[model samples]
Target: MRTARVQDLLGLLHGWYPPDQAEEWDNVGLQVGEATAAVEKLMIALDPSAAAVAAASAAGARLLVTHHPLLFKPLRRLTPDDPVGGVIWTAVRDGVAIAAAHTNLDVAADGLNRWLAARLDLLEAVPLQPAVGHLVKLAVFVPTAHAESVADALFAGGAGQIGAYDQCSFRVAGTGTFRPGPGTAPFIGEAGRREQVEEVRLETIVPQRRLPRVLEKMLKAHPYEEVAYDLVPLANELPGVGLGRIGRLAEPVALAAFAARVKAALGCSSLRLVGVPERTVAKVAVCGGSGAGLIHEARRRGAEVLVTGDVKYHEARLAEDLGIALLDAGHFATERLAVEELAERFRAGAAERGWRLDVVVFEGDRDPFVVY
Candidate 1:
């Protein structure tokens, strides 16, 4: 089996998701490593800590895929004197590659939120926010006989999608009139007399990021020299890319029982809670980290409880006043799934390339905390 290059792996990741979609300040992709390096051994961890790096080295892993970036802030220099800088130096010397998929993977369809939702057994999972940008509505006139073919081609290049449905569209049949100019060659009409043909108005939505490819595909499949089409900018919101999630439990349980179940599910030692323990809690809202900001939104949305991480003292006070049950599951606990999820993706990719990639999870990667 041939080992895959680091660049090839990066390309596969970007093909499904673009790193540019991440927050402007987020640092994703390769932190260090050779592009041409052959990757046979791999390690997955939440953070790129010294211990995690040492473990990867000991396992003979040539690549490390982490959820959080090793270098969140810009580096001043690569000198060995600096603590963080020293880690980078050691990685380069040991020939270990680093890569991260942060907010981009979090907001994508079937992304981080889906993994979280599945863990809690939330059914009918859809995007909490839809893709708003990189979207264009295409309205084109085609012959009634060929409309289906054109529509199918557009769908192949990422079009005709609204919410949960794909290949979605609206069609209306009408008479289209046009005359060919002297230099123009017409497909269905004469050069002089005005000609009318039966046409179907086919409309679908395409991503702005894929506009060029979509347009090219539409034109190639369209059977008219002058393909009449309109591109409209959409201001509609999408539930796919938004922060946090709102879902219902398999069955409503008491607030106290719900909290206990969540703690056991995440394997966390302790957390803060709001609202009466005996109240029946059904609907739940969850965000991975620092989600205290969404407390009011969750309450307004009628969620009985909001499970998140990193609640400030004042935020906890506010949550108490709101009468909404809130639980802080700790930052690392909420996001640890990201590392394991990414590892699964890498293992699948490696299998496709006929290379053996071992995705080992180090038990020592947990946060340094204890509860008495």
Candidate 2:
């Protein structure tokens, strides 16, 4: 295995959480660095702050992957006085690349919200508001000899997946008739002569987000100069990828007891509860970071309580009116687990690919809000 580059690891990250899955308002993917930059070590953090940048550089890490993006809005100036500018200056000086997963990771199948729900032991959790991904059937006609190769390329480019299974494809053997036109260099048969050749129609299902890449790879692997393919849109919804999760605990626990469990599990310095202390609750909904927005959806999903961070006053009142409990676990505390989770996943990927890369989780960051 050769040295892993920034873009190489990015391929693995995007495979898990495609950038297109991010909310329209969110900016994800590479924020600051060249894609081809060599990376021997990677540091994962919750935020792309100056501290994270400095830590990565000091630790000799060439890449820094963060859950939060370094740049959100357009930059009007590039002075050191500005916070974002300072981070950029430090990163450029140290030659450390920065990339963000952001909302894409939030709404992925095995994402932050799912990890949070698992930590709390939410049994049989489903999305509070399901965000089904668009699916398409890609049918490509290839010569029988090259069908397997083309199918392999499509699978490598993020195609042929249904639920837990991958590399799924269907091939039908048939005879193809075609005639090469002028100035055309055909892989088989002579120009201006009608010919019939044995071919196989390879079909696979691809998420819309991966279609472009899948097509690119398939075209490259095809034997013909002009590949014959059909992309038919499907009405089927890709399941298990969305924001927030609604489920019940193994058994009912008092609202206050559940709150204590959350504090202990998340290691929060402090947390706020917006319901009666002794209220018995079984059904629960959980979302990491600022998920107060899911309160109504949770209620609709039959969750007796919603656990999330950054709950606004009106949202809390709405939860109250809806007869649901609210637990504000603090944004930093809720999202801090992303660093370790991403690091763990990246480590496994690197090892599987036989790359000698060090995956480090940044632990220097602290919650911005402090309690006296």
Candidate 3:
């Protein structure tokens, strides 16, 4: 049986939800274990609690993928007596690697918020606040014969990727002139002589997060001893990624009815609502976890009701004053739906890559809260 390495899974996860999309404070990506370690079985969960670790170990899983990261803060010690330290110790002892998707998964196009909207059958859903990132236009001068090779290297290093497209670039034939200074070893001409060579100007778009690796690959692949390149910053928003989402319902429904629909879809025992039951709502906005901060934005985007978790008393009051309905559907309940979805995605990706790996959803995990 062919075993998939930790790096392979990371590639698939990051390809769909790049870590750059995560908030500044989030700790994402591989938290424990080596990327080169072989993984034969993987488990997906919402949190990295002690029970989750034990369940993964019991199932003989080599990797534990979670929505929440274990190491949120810097650790001063690694003693098993501590809470976070105990989870770390258990994972290491059981030979289980740990990874997290976190805020990046929340912001992805196929992220938790999107799933929530789809579950409620929202119409014309769009991001409440679109994600903005630095984009750079990389222009590189390459020898005519080596343009294709250099472009290939840039693409491999994570450049030229736009929505649903890869290896996208533009090239123009041009001329290049260079004088190899003393002590310089030229790839095409004598060290002390002036050289005029036919070259191509290759231009491509790259995300700022990928600039370093792309430049490294470009330099390594260019034929010239002194590679010339220009990087210009662009002011543009990244497409298909953001925090929260707003959309309309196919038909208007009472606020109480919408709350009931949310409870049923999310498998919640009960949820808090902050509006009149008879109030009618057609436009809805949703954020997966702890999204009270987006209430004002939702209202600004014309959402009559906002469905999210972790709404404070004051925030709920504010929602009522703003004349928008608010639903607090427990943080765990709102986000846990992604566990099975993530497992299925990984399973399909593994099969496509011919990796003999078992993907399992950790049903042993549960909400920490209990209603008396």
Candidate 4:
């Protein structure tokens, strides 16, 4: 197996959830370490805390993938005193790379909220706040002899992906004509002479975020003085990519019973509930980590109950006013599942793709909240 770099491992996650999918206020993607650094072991965790960084270094993890970023706002200085900076310093000193998924992971199709829904056994779960996917159709003209190689380069560079299919492309034989001008080097034909050659019009789908890299690779693989390619923007309007999720239980259960199930499912030692215990809840919505702001959106989506964390007094009152049940699962408890989920996903994805990456879930994850 070939060695993978830190950037390569990061690309696997970003393929599913690009930083562009994150909210404008968020800072996703790399926080620490060099992209060219070779990586063999990866550590997954909910936060890029000091403990997580130390654990990664101790466990000999070359990279740390976390749900939350070590640095959100830009720091004016780097020191071991600042909590965020300390993590950064430790990662740098210990030679461990650090990257975050953040809102990108939160808004991904199979993101944190969807994982939470799956754990609760929610059926037909859909994003409460849905956003469409942005894609580009890449049409490139390549010499017939180089078509396959160029297509392979594009695929390796993060192009030609259309849900469960990869290395996908459409090709048609055609003749391309070009004139080599003075002081120009052409792959074929003499200067100042018009030439026609057999070519293939290759077309494929590429996520808008990966266009630059894909184009670069395609150009490198093409046997032409000047590569001809077109980037046509697409309106895929694909579902499943967004924040929060609304779904139904197999059957309706009393509010109290549902709360108990949620508390047990998420392993929350305590919960804050709004509305009477006898209220029946069949439709439920959830947003992992500080999703009380989505209560109205969930209600609008026909959700009788909203399960999330960090509910404030005002938010609870609004839920009551809206006649929807609310369950306050702590933010840590609600979003913590992503650690193990990401570890397992990376393990499977790496194995399938020959990444030679070893993933481990951080064991030091403990919700700051303690029940008295």
Candidate 5:
């Protein structure tokens, strides 16, 4: 079995949920420890609380993966005196690497919100707010013999991915004429000679964040010194990826009954519900953590009710005014579902990659709020 490093685990997590997908204000990715550090035991949790860090350390976990970032705001110092700083100090001192998926995990196609919708048995669920990525179309001209190599490099560098298919590209064969000028080290034609070479036009889509690296790999793999390529901005948003989810229940239920269902599904002791109890509900929208902002979107998407967390009193009133039911399940209740889900995914990925690492879900992490 292969030993896993912190970088290896980061790679798998980022492949599933790219950091660029995170919200602009969100802090994500590796929070502490070296990428080269070995990871024999891994722990997954919803929050990077001090207790979670302590539990992970006691359990001999070398890496701690959490949905929430350990450090959200800018810190001037790292010491045991400050709460956030203390967690950082503990992880580093205990040799435990920390990584967070954050908004990127929330917006992924198979992210937390989607998992919540599935848990509630929503059907035909789609993103209420689809994730917008900086998309670019890359067209590269490569010699026929080197087309495959160049395309492979582009794909490996995170290009040519669309929805479920990866390495997706269109290739067209053509003849290209180029003259090698003085001081030009040409791969085909000699100096002062014009040559017609069989070439292929390989075109694919790339996220702008990965464009620079992908282009670099493409250039290195191309046979010509001066690789010909065209990059164009795309206006289309990425599909099957977004922050919140909107879907339909198999059958319509009363708003009150649905609220009960939400509480049961999320294992919450109580939830605040807005709107009439007897209102019929079929369509639903859900966002995992502090999703009160999406209430308007849910109303616009024809959702009869919105299930989310951390809704202020005014937000509930706004939902009522918009003629939609709102269920405020605790933020921790809704997002905590991802802890076990992520751990299972890590376990499966490690198994497939032949890495001998144990993935554990932190059971001690829970809601900080309690009703008297």
Candidate 6:
């Protein structure tokens, strides 16, 4: 069995969501264990609970990649004598390495935000806010015969994606000048004589974190001992990273019916609703948890109903004043939908690597709310 390294998993995750995309206050990445630790089996879940940790140990998983963190607030002690302090303590004693992808995963292009938006049937959905400072332009020169191979490698390494279509790159024909010195081996030129050869200038855009990999792929695939490449900083903004989502529905439904639809979609027993039933809901906005803070932004963007969690009394009153409907789906209920998407992602990723990954949805882990 081929064992995966913690750093390998981290590298793949960075492609999905670069660490800089995370909120500054958030703590992400490898929480415990060595980066080079051998990981054959893995357990993926929403939260790193005490029971989940125990389950991971029983399943013989050396690595656990969870969405919610086991330790959000800092811990000053690790002792089994205390009730709650021992949960983390036990995980450490069991030798399981834990990693978390929180807000960074939330704001990624194909990440939690987009996944949730699509689940709600939001057509024409795009990023609520484009990612800043994440796109870079790369220019390289390759021989005419090797241009396609080099370009393909960059695309495979997560470059050349502008909007749609893979392996997308712009090329221009040019003559390249280079000379090999004595004792130097050149793929295209003889030693000691400057030679002009037909070449193509290739250009592509890559995510900032993936620049290194893209460059490496280009170098390795290009048929030259000395590759010529330039990294140009670009002002072109990336449109696929953001916080909340706004989109149009299939058709407008009355606010009450729309709320019920959401409840059925999320399998929630109860939720707090604001605004009159007759209000039509077409334009919609949503953020998974504690999204009441974005109410004004949602209204400003012409959203008739803002579907989110954690609505306070004052927030509800303000929503009513704005004539915008507010659907207070429970925090856990809204966030729980993300788990299935996360599982699918890991399944596909692991399969591609020829590794077996099981995303176990902890049976019986549900919202702790009951109506008496």
Tens digits of per-residue lDDT, candidate 6, 206-325, equal: 878788898888888988888888888776756677888889999998989988988998888888889988888899888887789888888888889988888999999999899889
1-372: candidate 2 lDDT, tens digit per residue: 778999999999998998978998899999999999989999999999898899999999999999999998999999888899999988998999999999899888799989998889999988777776478899999999998899999999999989999999999999999999999999999899998999999999999988889999999999999889999988674588889888889999999999999999999989999999899999999889999988888888888889899999999999899998999999988888888899999999999998989999888989999988
Give the count of colliding residue pairs in each prediction: 11, 0, 0, 0, 0, 0
lDDT of 3 by residue, 264-297 (tens): 9999998999889999999999999899999899
TM-scores for all candidates: the values are 0.78, 0.87, 0.92, 0.81, 0.94, 0.78
Residue-level lDDT tens digits of model 1 in 153-248: 898888877767999889999999998888788888778769889999999887676778878888999989889999998766654665677788
Better of 2 and 4 by lDDT: 2
Q: For residues 118-166, what per-residue lDDT tens digits would candidate 5 score against the true structure? A: 9999999999998665799999999999999999999999998898799
Candidate 5 deviates by what RMSD?
Answer: 1.9
Which regions of candidate 3 deviate over 4 angstroms? 143-146, 172-178, 186-199
The TM-score measured for candidate 5 stands at: 0.94
| Model 3 residue 339 lDDT score | 95
Model-by-model lDDT, in order? 0.79, 0.91, 0.91, 0.89, 0.92, 0.80
Q: Once superposed on the true structure, which residue ranges of model 4 sit more than 4 Å away at CA? A: 1-3, 137-160, 165-204, 214-235, 353-357
CA displacement after TM-score superposition, residue 141 of candidate 3 (Å): 2.4
- lDDT by residue for model 4 (1-372), tens: 767898888888887778888888898888899999998899998888899899999999999999988777879998899888788889999999999999989888888989999999999998888876578899999889988899899999988777678888899999999998999999999899999999999999988788889988888888888888898888775457888889999999999999999999999999999999998999999999999888878888899999999999999999999999899989998999998888888888788878777888899989998989
Model 2 earns a TM-score of 0.87
Better-scoring candidate (lDDT), 2 or 6: 2
lDDT of 3: 0.91
> What stretches of model 1 exceed 4 Å from their correct place?
11-21, 34-36, 71-74, 121-134, 140-153, 161-201, 216-229, 235-241, 349-355, 370-372
lDDT at position 317, candidate 4: 93
Cα lDDT of model 2 overall?
A: 0.91
